[model samples]
Target: MKPAAFEYHAPATAGEAVELLAEWGDEAKAIAGGQSLMPMMLLRLTVFDHLVDLRRLHELRGIRQREQAVWIGAGTTHSAVGRSDLIRQSAPLLARATPLIGHAQIRNRGTLGGSIAHADAAAEYPAVALTLDAEFELLSPRGTRTVAAADFFTGMWATALEPDELLTGITVPEWHGRRGFAIEEFARRSGDFAMAGATVAVGLDADSRIDRCAIGLFGLGPGPERAHHIEREVLGSHVREVSAEEVGRAATARLTSVPADLHGSANYRKRLGAVLVARAWQRAVEEATDD
Candidate 1:
C-alpha cells in the first residue's frame, strides 16, 4: 500500500517549516526521518494533505554540550545518537536505550524528536526521556517555549505540542556524583517492540544510600510512566536495604492504566513490568555502588 497523495514541502529553515505547519494546520504534518509516519501513512492509518519536510533545516540536526546538560537537536538520527560520545558520557541512559529502538536500518532513519513526538508507550526513547527528566524545546508562530518530559506526553500517540509547534531540540540534564543508569525491556525478538520495559537511573551518596532515583516504565500504560511512588520509597534508603522485588511490586502496584492487547493482558503486562523493573533496579544499584 502507498500513502495517500500529499504535497511535500521541503523547508530550508525551521521558521519556514513552522509557518508551513501553521498555514496548513490539521491538513499538514511535519516529517523528520519519516520512519514511523511513513509506515502509518502507507497503511492508511493516517492521512495528511501536506508534508513539511524538515531535513534541510540545519538548525535541527546537531548535538551540543552545555554547561550542565546536553542538547540534542530534534532531527538527530537514532544512529547518530547511539554513536555520540557526548551522549554516552553525559546521558548514558539515552545512549543505552538507542540500540533497543529497532533494527539498524530503522535506527538509521529514525529521529529522536520523531520517536518522542510519536509518543509510543512501547518505545525506548520516550521512557528514557522521562527517566532522565529531559526538556523539550518547541517553536511556533507564537514564539518558543520549553516543556518538561513529565507534561509533554498526554497519552498514547499524543503530546502537548500544539498544531503549529515544532519540536526543535531536547535537553537532558547531566547527573553528577555517584550515579548509574540502566534500561531493561522484554521484547519477543531482537527488533520487536517491548512488551514491557523499565529504564532506571540511580544516584547514591558516599555511604551508598540512594539520594535520588527515577524509574521510567513503558509498554505498560497509555504513555510512558514514571514510578514516582517507588522512587520516594527508595530515596534515602541504603541500597542494600532496598529489595529489588519489593520495589518492583510497589512500582507496578501503582499503575492505574496498564493496557491489554493481542500480545498480553493488562495483568500479564504488569507482571512483566515488575520483573523488568526489579532487574533494572538491581543493575542500576550495582553500578552506582561500584562507582
Candidate 2:
C-alpha cells in the first residue's frame, strides 16, 4: 500500500509552512521526522493530499535554557534531547524516558514536537510533558497560542491542535535539583511499547524529605496521566522510608479503571500500573536522595 498522491513542500520557515497549510486547507498535513506519520500514511490510515515538510525550517531546531525553563525547538530529535548533558542535568526525566519511547533508529529521526502533536497515549513525551507541566507553542496563520500540557491532550489519538496549527516548540520548566526522577515499565521487549509504565520526578527539600512529586503512567488511560493521590501522599515523606506497595496502592485508587486492548486486560493493567507507579516513585526518590 502507498500513501495517496500529494504535493510535497519543504518550507524554509514556519510561516511558509503555515502559508502552504492555508493554501492546501484540509488537504495539507505538516510532517516532521515522519517516524509516526509515514507508517500511518503507507497503511492508508492517513490520506492527506499535500505534505508540508518542516525539516528545512531552521528556526525550530535548537535547545535553549532560561531562568524559568528550557525551550526545546519543535525540530529537536528525541535522540538529541536524550543525549544532551544539559537535559540530563536540568530535566533528567525527559532523558530517562526518551530511550523507552522506541528504538535508536526511531529516536534519531523522531522529533519532540511531532511526538507531542501525535499524542500517542503509549508514547513518553506526553507523560513527561504532563508531569513537568510543559507548555506547547502552536503557530497558525492568524498568530500564536500557548497550551499547557494537561489541557493540550483531549483524548485518545487527539490533541488541541487545529487543522491549520503547527507546533513550533515546547517549553519545560527548569530543574532546581528538587527531586530525582525515575521510570519503570513492564514490556516484553526492550523497545516495545509499554503494556504498563510509570514516570516519577520528585523534588526534595534540604531536610531530605519530599517537597513535591509528579507521577504519570502509560497504558492506564487515554494518555499518560498524573497519579494524583500518590503525589499528594508522597509529599513531605522521606523518600527512603516510602514503600513501593503504598505508592502503587494510591495510584490504583485513582486510575484503577482504564481501556484494555491486546496489551492486557483492564484488570491486569490496573494492578500492574499501581506496581509500576510505586517502583518509579521509589526509584526517583532514591536517586534524588543519593545526590
Q: Please give each candidate's TM-score.
A: 0.99, 0.94
- Local distance difference test values of all predictions, in order: 0.94, 0.86
Residue 40's C-alpha lDDT in candidate 2? 96
Per-residue alpha-carbon lDDT of candidate 1 for residues 143-235, written as tens digits (9 for 90 to 100): 999999999999989999998999999999999999988999999899999999999999999999899999999999889999999899889
Measured over all alpha carbons after superposition, the RMSD of each candidate to the real structure, in angstroms, is 0.8, 1.7
Which regions of candidate 1 deviate over 4 angstroms?
none
- lDDT per residue for candidate 2 within 38-59, as digits (tens), equals 9999999979999999999889
- On TM-score, the candidate that comes out on top is 1
lDDT of 1 at 9: 99
Which ten contiguous residues of candidate 2 have the minimum total lDDT? 248-257
Predicted model with the maximum lDDT: 1
| Residue 199, candidate 1: C-alpha displacement in angstroms | 0.5
